[model samples]
Target: MSGSRSVADRSRPVDGKRVVVTGAASGIGKGVATALVQGGARVVLLDRNVDAVTAVADELGATAIGCDVTDEDQVRAAMRGAAEHLGGLDGAVNNAGIVLNEPAESMSLVDFNRVIAVNLTGVFLCAREQFPFLADGGGSIVNTASMCAGIVVRPQPQVSYNASKSAVVGLTRSLAAEWADRNIRVNSVSPGYTLTELVRSPELAPQHEQWSSLTPMKRLADIDDLVGAYLFLLSDQAGFMTGQDIVIDGGYTVW
Candidate 1:
């Protein structure tokens, strides 16, 4: 915000970085976007929920768009808008997702497909669209996979969710390899049970309690706990890293 700042002060890992975050209207998306803006990144917040995203963006002095990641046209359009707002893209966070806890046998195909579309296909679309904008400068992409990707020991059934997230790990690796030549880095952050609005739901209380108990930390992770990993991956600090899944599951998958 001031021109008197020195280069080092202005060039902090996320400082002045142009980034796009999906699902920025609420929950984890909202938390990450807030952190980025505070850390000096110019963020373009995208979400299907127009009203909510607009409000949040305005509050943070960031740009906002009402676009669905599942739609190619909207994804392209959102990227275009982001470029216009931030001059160009430097990084992206594909954090848009949904969850359905139901028996695999009884889960309707429609329900399973919906979760995959948002959690899996959505990330693919966001990354693909943002690739062109980021390729010129060689940037970073962080997708939100879950501890469920590796551990499915919970009593509740999340077959579809687990399957989709596991695929994200594979997806991150493949993209990292392909983009490495362009100086682009791709990675994922697998968060443990976090205390977000969604996770704190009355319906999810039992699951939260169970996960909290099982976690080695004996407590759930806060959204802020996962921000450092994203910032590191987006910054030059992780210049040598790519195609890696940084698991921040509070040692949940270690056992």
Candidate 2:
């Protein structure tokens, strides 16, 4: 009781909380990890990139695990380790994902399944594995969905990516309802098109113009622009919120 915090302090937007973040070695994950540390939360960074994640952990004074979300064994092991390190799990940000830009006509089953595995199945695994850890403390879960989940990406082919993201939305809603009794709120953030290494690829560069034009804001989202939504969802401030999709798309989905 000597080190205990007041209720108000714990309820203030992720203060002194412990959280696990997937894909946390770089990009949006890195941004979230940085913000979480600044906001006073102990963060566990998980990613497929071992060295990179470890380096990030050292830099941020956070825990790091090299767990690929698509692999159940690795995820389980990582969660166990994270819980051990943090004393318990209070929330998680499942942000690990990949994208494929193949046309439906030429898309192979293997490639399509790969996308689903990482984007859809990965989320499912994280949520399921996180339940045991979160239920005890009334935890929060925020999955990274996309505006493409609700709206189609144009001037390119990404049928697999679109389908996978769409499934994430449905998954979030279904789990939110079923898990409400445990006080484990579930929600998602649909970032329009955030500026990150993934989006800065030479192949995706051309599509940037189309994506910006579609959004009334005339620009893609920066990682800075999207971390706040995630921070809110994983905080007690969103206690009354669940089964929701906070679309930070700059009005892209509005049209």
Candidate 3:
């Protein structure tokens, strides 16, 4: 009881925190950033699309930085910029990623490597750069993984995506362990197929029924459904939690 915090403190843990979110121009990243701002956190939105991200940042009253996560130099600059904008960093969401639905048998090496570079290596670069800013006060880092890391989805042959996401889980655990002494908590959120813009496109709309039928919840997740887990990880409520993956897949992986 001596060290316990009030319920209000735990409930509004992310208020006044300085947080950065990558790939924030759309989808899950945008949803998380919006939530952070609404929760009273100073947020910086980062994405390779400068115009789009800047627009979103302006709309949300947050800062924006154009950063291609796959590029180390760009990632370093973006992290520094975010730190400067917010005075320092308290949390980071490494959510930049890509997926290709190419068949493994005929997938070009270039295509495979490109996915790895963005999805896996990009996370490593962002986390590595964020360490310096977060090390000072013991911050949290949340990486975006996928339910595909545990089980492959049907009707799609995305070997590269599956492989990259699986590695993200491993990377999250490794970083959490290595940085525990520095008091930097690292964790991941693995969301099942969400109805993001890409997923809502005409090309993929036909597959929605198939995807929904596979989930025990009988539906896909909404961006709102997944942002709460990210907010929790970034808050002091999860002070002792690290190196864990919160899978929000509507029971898709259960089967």
Candidate 4:
């Protein structure tokens, strides 16, 4: 009669959890949504690109909603739609981001503010709308940040990107603390040099290569490679985890 228990003591786990993933039409968001679906969760894919989102949603048989993440009204409507379609919302991935790569000197206020608005304000808007839905089920949130949050990513100075992602880390922690009593866990994943369509662009590939070389892995990460971390954060397996930024940067921050 010690601390041991029978096999039945184990919980049924995170199967059947309903999660909303923004920017799910492609890249890391799509990968996370796909992984969650394969693991038996109901996923709602929200993206600004309606056609691509529709195609992906059709392929995955998930509910798809097209909305601009930066628009508060659209973000709220999307969350409402997700709640209505999924019957209830359990979690969300605030992964919609825009990258503007230019030298800081040449970067204009308009360009800088645009990136901040989408990357930082967008995450806040999504989370603000999603909290009530998720609180109903007491769930987890995993935001997609970047290695630039903690590290000095020089040579290709994306000052706005760096600032926005750093703010994400802070926001995740703050929200985690604020909602701990409600059993709403908040966390983030900071991926480094992830290979996406954006990375493959002629303007970004060389920078991507440079960043990849900086990582100990010596290669850029596939979007799928970041899936496990998201899964773990959203699943009950990480129940004790909150207010943490799980860096999946292949040791890029070590230097």
Model 4 whole-model lDDT (C-alpha atoms)? 0.87
lDDT of each: 0.89, 0.91, 0.95, 0.87
Better of 3 and 4 by lDDT: 3
lDDT of 3 by residue, 1-255 (tens): 365778877778789999999999999999999999999999999999999999999999999999999999999999999999999999999998888888899999999999999999999999999999999999999999999899889998899999999999999999999999999999999999998975787767899999999999999899999999999999988989999999999999989
Off by over 4 Å in 3: none
- Candidate RMSDs in Å, in order, are 3.7, 3.1, 1.0, 2.5
lDDT of 2: 0.91
The residue ranges of model 1 lying beyond 4 angstroms of the native Cα positions read 1-11
Clashes of each: 0, 0, 0, 0
Clash pairs, model 4 backbone: none
Off by over 4 Å in 2: 1-12
**Model 2 TM-score on a 0 to 1 scale:** 0.95
Residue clash pairs of candidate 1: none
lDDT per residue as tens, model 2, 59-116:
9988899999999999999988998899998989999989888899999999999999
For model 4, the stretches where C-alpha displacement exceeds 4 angstroms are: 1-13
lDDT string for model 4 (1-255, tens) is 454433432342346889999999999988888888888889999999999999999999888999899899999999999999999888889999988887889999999999998889999999999998888769999988898899767577688999999999999999999999889999999998888875777887767767777888888888887998898888777878999998888888897
Candidate 3 lDDT score at position 73: 95
